[model samples]
Target: MLCAYTKLGMMVDARHLFDSMGERNSMSWTTMVAGYANIGDMKAAKEFYDLMNENNAVAWVSMIAGYGKCGEVGTARRVFDEVVVPDASSWAAMESCYAQKDMRQKLLSYIQANEENVDGTDATVWGFFIRCL
Candidate 1:
């Protein structure tokens, strides 16, 4: 229900449903974060993200993408830095964020660093590098 409202851009209704959920799991929390992000409410998304007891990859990616969409690349970078184990989706989101800002040098550095640390880069990450280059 909440996800449906969120996807439909009915943020207020989605938020109400989110608030009504008695036992909000990680998916519920992530949906709220994504909802706020989808509505261009990065601050609200970040606030909800901070309040969560457990932050999953989807939540983190959504928050980071929200920050980027709001033109707060530094804040997104800080959030990325704090991620303990960033999955391909998280890295792809961050890469897209940087690419959107035309920060090619930073994107290259990030890809290089991730390649050195991780086994391989995801297709989206490679796409970011290719598009930026």
Candidate 2:
């Protein structure tokens, strides 16, 4: 119900329903974070994300992609950079967003800075870079 309302752009209603829940899980929190991000409400998204005690790739990706989707690519890139050792999925998510935005130069610049972590010798990583272009 909360997700439905949020998807429908009824954040007020979504919040009301969310607050009424007796117990919450990662899905519940991620839903709100994704919802706010989808609407370009990065502030709200960040607030909800910060409230979470734990985060998985899905939660973090939501924020990275959300910032990109909102044209706040720098913020997205910053989030990606903050991860000491971003896994393949995390790197792929943000890089894909840059590709979608035609920000290939920015992506390439990131690759230059983080080559050690990106597994430059991996064919799959090369595949991702090719696909991005």
Candidate 3:
């Protein structure tokens, strides 16, 4: 229900539901994080993300993408760099961020740096490469 409200951009309703919940699992917490991010409230998203008891890749990517969406590419990069164990999705999120910002040089540099580390088969990164060219 909360996710439904969030997906529909009804943050007020979602927040109400979130506040009413006595206990929250990671999914519930992550939903709020994503909700805040989707609503362009990166500060709120970060606050919830930092409050997460166990930060997973999805949560980290949420912040990365949210910061990027808000045009805070440098902060997004910092989040990318601070990730303890970044998976392919994390790298792809950063790449997408750079691409969306049209920072071609930075995107190229990042691609080159991660050429060996990234999953070549990942479609998102491949899409980034295609967009860069």
Error of 1 at 40 (Å): 1.4
How far off is residue 112 in model 2, in Å? 2.9
The best candidate by lDDT is 3
The TM-score ranking, best first, is 1, 3, 2
Please, what are the lDDT tens digits per residue for candidate 1 over residues 1-133? Answer: 8889988989889888888888888888889899898778987888889899988888888888988888788889888877887777877778778878988789788768767655453576667667767
- Flag regions of model 1 displaced more than 4 Å: 113-116, 121-128
lDDT of 1 at 99: 72
- Candidate 3, 129: how far from true, in Å? 4.6
Instruction: Summarize candidate 3's per-residue lDDT along 13-56 as a digit string, tens digits.
Output: 98899989998999989988888887789988988898989877
Model 2's alpha-carbon lDDT is: 0.81
Q: Which 10 successive residues of model 1 have the least lDDT summed?
A: 116-125
**Candidate scoring better on TM-score of 2 and 3:** 3
Relative to the unseen true structure, what is the Cα RMSD of model 3? 2.2
